[model samples]
Target: MAGGTVLVVGGGLAGITAALGLADAGRSVTLVEARPRLGGLTHSFRRSSRAGDLWVDNGQHVFLRCCTSYRRLLDRLGVSDLVSLQPRMDIPVRSGASPRVARLRRSALPAPLHLAGALAAYRWLPPAARVSAARAALALGSVDPDDPAVDEESFGRWLARRGQGPRAVEALWDLVGVATLNAPAERASLALAATVFQLGLLESNDAGDIGWVRVPLQRLHGDAAARALAAAGVRVELRTRVGRLPTTYDDVVVATGPAVSEDLLPGDALDLAPGWSARLGSSPIVNVHVVLDSAVLDEPFVAAVDSPLQWVFDRTAGSGLDPATGQYLALSLSAAEELLGRSVAELREWTLPELGRLLPRSRSARVLDFFVTREPQATFRAAPGSRKWRPATATRLPGLHLAGAWTDTGWPATMEGAVRSGEAAVASVLGRRTERTALGATA
Candidate 1:
């Protein structure tokens, strides 16, 4: 525990979290990052605004009330005041020719009773559907995440058996799936969807309430994390990728990508040997940003009820813009496997019309150019039966810990997972002893 220096080889939120956690715990550490800046996927840059220079996130990210760990990170970084938490469970879902909005609220009745009150008065649902949706929610909440059968059935199948038909599923249950997993009901795993619900809704009355960033992703996450780490006396190095570990010593953290992890260890030990580690897969995300003449959206973030666009975020005030001619909107397409290879032009062809259709005022709005960004492997594919593949924070290699959203953090591959993985990696590193990694055909 004395006179030991650790090297963490990444600068994403997880890496930053690990470094800071270790440093705060009285450990000396150096962080190496491959990119010029930190923040990994959540980044921002200068964009033109009527009020002058502006910053906006690549895409908006939101959290549920139950995400206590994430909130604690914000508080530690002193940015808690920069965000807003929806005080009540309010979901505004809209679809089709005429937009219909339904807001889900809670009552003092408690647990299933609160859910029943919200569902009984849910106007968008038919009388029969309201009852069916309630039953389905109850059924989903009652299902145990530990049960093997939960992962065997598709969420769509489970919903259907619980009385949710196609339209009702799209309007109600699908919102739950896509809002959480970034996939529609049919595409997502029943176990994952149920976990999202059980953890978010049934477990607590206001836990499903949303919280989103009031500023750009990079400023809110990367810059804040880097600054906090530096203040804590952590050495933060960016653009210095580590291809191999300093084998001269036995204590270090490998927080890089799949290739780097495999490159560092003996006999291709980190290569996962086509087993647990090798089984890691990824999903794609597509983000589109557009500027209009006026504020097209008021909410900080919104999940598209029954559309291919999973979520949308409004960046007006945060971008230093006048509401009239300086409103920016970002659309995030999660699990965007189909749209991964499409050109931005082809994407805009369909997306622009959809946006206009959703926000009628945008029909007459002037186009201030558009931009789209795609990440083919933004996160690990969290499909059914895939849970067994996600590894823990510690590996067989001593002093070599893993930190990423893919690790088993009892959460979907998310920002929270990334932060949690980093914290776990640090804990594992701090507990390391005089032992070293074996140099044999490791796995």
Candidate 2:
């Protein structure tokens, strides 16, 4: 654990964090990644164009200010300046083209009281629903995420029992739940939802303040992490696939996706259950990127209600789009199983009009180009009983361990969970106690 080589398979945030943690602890680390770059799911690409090539992220990843571990990772990589956190929690939420943009803002008050004004004034929900939302939020703060019964029920069912109806679920619950849990409230586990809501919104005043990278995710995660780890004397291997566990290292961390980890992990080496990985089913996410002739959206980010647009981010600067020519916007659709098979042309036809509806400036602006990015198995489905499938960092095989967002970190499949799992894996390898870092949630 002190000096022997520790092999970390997968170049994701989880793998990167583990490698860095190990190397910092005076242990020789080798990070093997199947992809050419470091970032696994969170990456960027170059979009060819007649004018010039543009840098675009594969998916939009948003984090909260309370994500201390991820923030520490950023600091370690020396890319902390590449991202910015909002001054406070202010979400521009639109419900169709109602001309009324509901602002979900938080005050500087203590927990639970910080959001009372925002919730009371939320225009999307009726007055009665807003009252019920307060009650429900308070109730969520009391629910324990570790209880087996909590994971067995859907957040929607719990909210319904607390007087939340369809309108409230759509305007309030789904608005936040679907984006975080990657599923609707009706399908997401109450345990995960409770963790998201309690830690993110109810526990602290600044926990929900949003932060996002100003540059491409590749630069922020993959390239920066690679540079950081290599400088620490860590052996970095890219575009390398380990079909079987290599016996060269003292310890190996299987940090790949859930299904891929199950595949790469030797059957006879560990005493894991045969159906363990299978139980953590996957959920899909679809991202629609559009370049328009004008800056339709003024805000950096926005959330939608009663619209196909779940969340939209203006990536004009990040995408290297010439402000004088056109603007670029990326729309993230979580739990996007229905839209996975849709063609880009079909998606463009509908999404453009929806954008125009939300932003009147887009009504007359011409669409320069449109494209879609799909992740069929983006994250393990955080539905009912998912906690039972999530394994701990330690495995039966002392030489091999696990690390990924799918593992139990008391959070959903987000950047925070990925980093937390990595640290946990490192702690397991070092035979040290794991210290829980501060962070609210991730995308």
Question: Model 1: per-residue lDDT, tens digit, 49-86?
Answer: 44456676665678888887678788878788888888
lDDT at 126 for candidate 2?
A: 86
Q: Rate the local accuracy (lDDT) of all candidates.
A: 0.73, 0.88
lDDT of 1 at 304: 66
Per-model TM-score, in order, reads 0.90, 0.96
Once superposed on the true structure, which residue ranges of model 1 sit more than 4 Å away at CA?
A: 1-3, 48-53, 248-250, 258-272, 275-278, 434-443
Candidate 1 residue pairs in clash (backbone atoms < 3 Å): none
What does candidate 2's lDDT look like per residue over 122-148, in tens digits?
Answer: 998889889988998999999999999
CA RMSD (A), model 1 = 2.8
> In lDDT terms, which candidate is top?
2
Q: Which stretch of 10 consecutive residues in model 2 shows the poorest summed lDDT?
A: 434-443
Give residue 100's error in model 1 in angstroms: 3.5
Worst window of 10 by summed lDDT in candidate 1? 434-443
Highest-scoring model, TM-score: 2
